[model samples]
Every structure is written in structure tokens, then in C-alpha cells.
Target chain A: MKVTHAKLLAQVPLLTDLPTELLESLAKSCRFEQVNRGHVIIERHDTTRRFFFLLSGQVRMLDLNRQGQEIALAILDAPTHFGELAVIDSLPRSASVQATTRCEVASISPQDAEKLIYTVPQVSRKIMQNMATVIRNNNLHRQVLQQQSISNRLAAYLLGQLPKDIDPKETVCIRNLPIQYDLSILLGTTRESISRALTTLVDEGLVTKDGKNLYLNDIPGLYQLLEED
Target chain B: MKVTHAKLLAQVPLLTDLPTELLESLAKSCRFEQVNRGHVIIERHDTTRRFFFLLSGQVRMLDLNRQGQEIALAILDAPTHFGELAVIDSLPRSASVQATTRCEVASISPQDAEKLIYTVPQVSRKIMQNMATVIRNNNLHRQVLQQQSISNRLAAYLLGQLPKDIDPKETVCIRNLPIQYDLSILLGTTRESISRALTTLVDEGLVTKDGKNLYLNDIPGLYQLLEED
Candidate 1:
């Protein structure tokens, strides 16, 4: 789908909070690009000239291990903003972002982003708050993953990815699991470990898998698993 | 130790950049507190009404695993600032901070910190830049640690803790080792792993260990080891 001006401006999380006039200005400054799956949208060491926000589809932020294996940092979906670090620090890109699926993304020039920071306090504060949230949550998530148990890591990883606003009683259906190989990269483990953990979760009736969809029967069960020695 | 108006203001990294009038205002707003070793300066759910800067001695940021084992996050020395995340986001403290030694720490209320942000653009920019640097470096460090090598982790970790301005060619001394238990917690490994990794480094002449003092004989050797796997 082509990214329409008003629709996209109002849809993106970054611009959605702005007033109509500011949104209009943002819309004017943004350039929308459609990228195919497997497109490397941003490479490590890329210039700090522009920031990106996903309007649709998925993107993976990743790094390469010394052995040339891809280590997944984050798998981001629509309404997500990234690359702001480069803008804030005026530094080269620290990681690579690639399209995991055909994606619609909006790019904003750093000059415009900086102008927004000074001219628009509300937007600036929101961005900073968002960054703080990411930093804090990412730190917590990494701490969970650092433990030596693959089961605990997978459980904590799944729980961490749920939206903050997700209803406690809601049965969250996650169907976009790419594949076991991809999941292994995300957890920094092997495909065998991912499969083993999934089997255990299924055997315990904590979660059920049907085709590409996974169902959480008991969210607290996952937490209980983490508490196990 | 009493916190003199000039001495305290000069030592705190946050206030050092401000002009005299501003520093005077900040010094007045700050509360200088001397804490003893093992003092719990901040708890997990503490309010973010104030921020802290260490004037002297060591502070450790830590968390408890489900089994009640401690997980070390960071060990900070003088001229370090923390709890700004709470101040920035108005969120509860994400972790616990304990004084690792008798410490002199100065704190500023969020209200005063806000005043500085409005009154001092350069200082605010510098704080943001520092925060961005933290986020980037933390991400990289976590990535390095997540790989499955205890020796690589200890090497990368020591290299990481070195002051960024340290001369690459100079023989820098880091004598503030926090014992084997704390080192194991920081690396999410067994105490035995820490001992083994240290022995390996010493054996290879990559680093030399003298009592609690560990000396890096060749920093590049550690980096090369990381590149090997």
C-alpha cells in the first residue's frame, strides 16, 4: 500500500502525538519508502543524517558475530521508531536494520528532527521519554536473557515483547514467529534449544502451538518457569 | 566528610559544567550525604524525585534473581551519576543501589535538575549525549557478553570498564576489584569460571594479576581474542 500523507502522519507513533499543524509539518518533512523483504534498510556505520519509523511490516535490528552469524538485537513491528541514537549523538550507526517483511517506512532528516527538538518541546520530551523507556526495558530484558537457562530466557523474552498496554487477562496471540532459526538468533541460542524449550512449554500446558500460531494458556506459568532453579 | 560548597560542586560531574552562579544555586539545592559501606542508597521501587552523583567511593547497582542470588549490574566510582532515568521518566527506580564502600554522594531534586535543564542548554545537551553514549555502549557490552565464552567476557569486561580516555599504550592500573563473588555476578558465571578466565589471561600474558590488582599487559591481545570467535 502506498503511504498516504494524512493517513501516515496520523498513523506513525512519533507524529501521532503531535498537533495537526506540527503533524502537517512533520508530514512535509518526511519521505516514505517501501522496502522489500530482505532489504538492508540501514547498515552499521551508516551516516546519522536521517531517522526511521515503521509504518507497516517488520524490521530486525541485528549484529554479526565474529563467525558471521546474525545475532538478533530486536525484531520491531509497525509504529516503531529507531535510528534516533545516531541523530542524538551525531555518530555513525551502531547496528544494522533490515526489513523482515515488505515494509513501509518514513524517514525524517536530522535537520528537521533537530528543529523539532528545539521548536517543539512536547515532541522532544516525548522522544526522550520513549528513549528512556527503551533503555530501561532493554536493560531489564538483557538481564533476563543473560541467565544460563534457555527455557528461562525464552519465557522472559516472550513476556518482555508483549506490548506494555496489553490487557492482563487477554489471551495474546502471537503468530508472526519467523522460524526456529530466526527465533534461535533472537534468543542467542541454537535452533535445538528453541525447539526443546517450546516442547517443554507445550508439555507443561503453559503454551500451545498450532501451525505458525502460539497460544499462551497461562501467562503466570511462564513466570513460574523462570522462578525454577 | 563535610561537603563544602566549592569542593562538592567542583567534584560532581553534573554541576562542574555550570557557571558559578548556577553552581551556587545547585550546591544550595543539593543534599550532601555520607553513607557507610553496604548502605542501600536506593531500592528497586524508590521514587525518582531526586538523582544521585557519587563524590567518593564505590556504589554497586544490583538485582536479586528468583533463587535469591545477586546479579551485579554495575560498580561505579566517584564522579558517577545515576537514577536520572527515574527523574527523566518519573518512574520507580529500576534496580537497587548499595554503597560498596564508605561513600560521599550528592543528590539534586528533580525540580532543581529541571531548572538546570532549562537554564543550561549546554549541560542538558551534554547529559543527553552522555545518555546516548550509555545506551549505545551498554548495548554493545551486552552483545559481547551474551556470546558463550567466559574468558572472552572477562577480557571484554575489563577493557570496557577502563576509562575511555585511558591511553591505549600506557600501563593503566585498576585496583578496585570487587572480589570473585561480585565478578561472577557481573558476568553471570560461576566463581570458578572467573578464576579460570583470570588464570587463562595470566597464563597467556594478556593480563597480570597481583592480589586484587589486575593489570592489562596488552589490551589489543584481549581484543584479538574476541575476534577469534
Candidate 2:
């Protein structure tokens, strides 16, 4: 069981550089959990400081305002870790983490997480790299929000979600987009605004909506919307 | 001169935990600069990867859209560092950094920065803690933006800038507030919206403004605005 857990943890992107011995030790310190869909994995402002690494499935990090409106922050797929910020800083959870789908996760106690960071060079480097990515993405998101139009922001979002290697002129059909409410929250606009943005995209012949999927009819046109007023 | 640089680096909150020997080595690798007000220290998307430690004065991290509109991200005070993200991840500058006042900064080359992070346990730990603070504050800012009201965001921004230990009932005067345009950018609103929000605050008797200063007549009232619709 310990070996199996260690092997599983070794597959995590954040822990890939960690040595086998360290992985075994970490596996010992971690408590594995099987979370059901819609489970509140970590609550906003909760004092618990455990570091969680998702083994499978997906989760969404969000915050609820005083009016109880959910603000979607990000959705995380498996093989990524969360809650390390609170664990490192000893602060309350910055936002709540909810399982968007059933998930398997491994959680480490605060002491174990601290030990790994303080004693292991690779672990600390990995954490810093991961955090740098988060901060950079957050900065980009801020830039998108400041673009001043829901359609522009939505265009940027779609471009970001698609594979980078896809040719600009090539048509691509992206499936399993988040629901309208989640998209609205992520784009920092109302659901009605999102609907209007989609209509605008459809009218411009840049995108075609088919059930849960969206097809890019003109990828360059979507980019043009972001570049123009 | 190296010893002088070491002493200055020692005072930085991020480097305070670093040992004397590491500070000496770091000082050797760092290039110091004296920047005039409005100097662009780091430009957005610049490929240069250098970690900067601010020795004195203030700098604003901002991004400019294609239309050349500025969006202020944060105003970083002295004794803190920036650009570590680019150094750690070898990414382009996430945002531009401009001196808000005459400033002194020490910069480490990408090689030296990487060496420090990889070899120094204390340095890496401190970076993680600092990044954690940045992420938490970013999360809070996102929540503030999601509040969906310019007044609520402005109030939250004011509360964040003020000293936290102040008594809620005691009237307090906060001076040297950012210019209206900068406030507008930081709160994700327009200057007109910020003016209207300020007017709303005054009409509610929660705040009073004098030229460049703001007086909080009812701190709790501002908090209540955040709590209510």
C-alpha cells in the first residue's frame, strides 16, 4: 500500500522531481481521501492547513460573497495540488475548493508539508514554479478583465482554452465548456452578458454553438475581436 | 560596497531569513539602480529575467492593453521584491513595473536568482511565503471585484490600505490616496464610476473627503456595505 501510494504521488506534476525516498515518506504522511461530486473539499476562510494533491477527477476553486453569490476562481484537473499557500503561510483558506467531479486526493498535514518545503530543495523549487504559474495566470486574467467588454474577454478565454499548437486558420471544435453561470463568473460578468457575448460571436461568424460544444469557424476573427474595440 | 549591499539586502522582508553568508554572495551578484519617478523598471512581456528587491521608495505594477490604457495591479512599497516569477519560471515579465517615486532597487540576474532559490532553503521558503501572501491578496481582490459594485470595491480597497489595528468607532483620516484614475484602474472601474462611488459614500455619511485626503466617519458602515447587497 505504501509503495502504491508513493508511486501514485510520484506521478503528480508538483512531485515529479521529488526522489523515490521522499515520495515514500510523503506517502506515509498523506491521508488519502475519496471525495464525492460537489463535495466542498476545502471551505473558504477555514483554518485547516492541510495540503491537498488531487489524484483524479476535477475540482473548482471559488468564493462566496456576503450575498452568497459564487465567484468561480479556477477549475483544477487531477495531478495538481492546492491549499499549499495556506499551509505555507498559516493563513485561512483563501477560497473554497469543491469537487466538480468525484475525486481521489492525498492530503498532508501542515507539519509534513512544512518539513518537505524546508528540508527538500526540489520540493521548494517545484512549489515556487507552480506558484509563479498561478501568479502569471492571475495577472493575465486581470488583463482580460480590464479589456472592458464581455465579448472581448470571452474571446480571450476561448483562445486560452484551446490547444496552442492548433493553426490559427484551422477550425477546431472544443467540447465540455463550463456552464453559462460559471463562464459568467469566470469572465466577471452577468449570465445575460455572457449570452449576449455568445450571440455576438455567432453573429460575427467567429463561433458556432452546437449543444455542449463550440466550433471555431474563424479563429483569427476571435483574435481580431480582442485586438479591436 | 558589497558589504553595504549585503546590509541593505538583509533588511528586505523576503531576505531577512537568509543567512549573512548568503546575503554576501547575493550582494556580489546583484546590480543596484537609482530610478527616477515614473521610470519603467520592468516592461510588460520583456524577455529579460531578473529578480528585483526594492531598497526604497515605491513602484506600481501595471499592464497596458493594446489601446494603451493602464491597469494598475498593485503599488509595492520598499523592502519587498518583484520579478522573481519571471526569474523562477523563465517567463516574460508578467506586468510592467514603474517607479511611483524616486526609488532604489537591487536586481539579481536569472542565473544568480536560480542559484539562490535552488541552494538556499531559507530563501526558497521565504519566497513561498511571500508568494502565498501575493496569491491571498489577489484572491481577496478578485472577491472585491466580484462584489459587482464600484462603491463596495472602493470601500474594500480603502479598508485594505489602512492600518488594520484602528478602532472601528474612532474616526480616522487617511492621507495621500492614489489619484482617481489609478483608483479607477485598481478597482476595475472608470474614473466617473469612482467619483460616483465617492459621492455615494459621502451621501451615506460614511466618509468625508478633503482635497487629497479621506476621513472615515464610520468604518463599520463601510464594512456593512460589503456585507449588504
Give the interface RMSD of each candidate.
2.2, 2.2
The residue ranges of model 2 lying beyond 4 angstroms of the native Cα positions read A147-152, A189-200, A224-229, B147-149, B162-166, B189-200, B210-212, B224-229
Candidate 2 local Cα displacement, residue A142, angstroms: 1.9
For residue B104, give model 2's deviation from the true position in Å: 1.4
Which candidate gets the maximum DockQ versus the true structure?
A: 2
Docking tier of model 2: it is: medium
lDDT by residue (A136-179, candidate 2, tens digit) is: 77876766665567898888888877876898888899898887
Candidate 1 lDDT, A72-166, residue by residue in tens = 77788897788877888899887899998899988888988677654465656666677677677666766666767787787777777576687
TM-score of chain A of each: 0.84, 0.90
lDDT of 2 by residue, B143-191 (tens): 6665557898898888876786888898889888887877987887789
Evaluated with TM-score, which candidate comes out highest? 2
**Structure candidate 1, residue pairs in collision:** none
Candidate 1 ranges with C-alpha deviation above 4 Å: A1-7, A162-181, A218-221, B1-7, B117-120, B161-179, B190-192, B218-229
**For residues B9-64, could you state the per-residue lDDT of candidate 1 as single tens digits?**
67666667666766676677789899999999999777756878788888888876
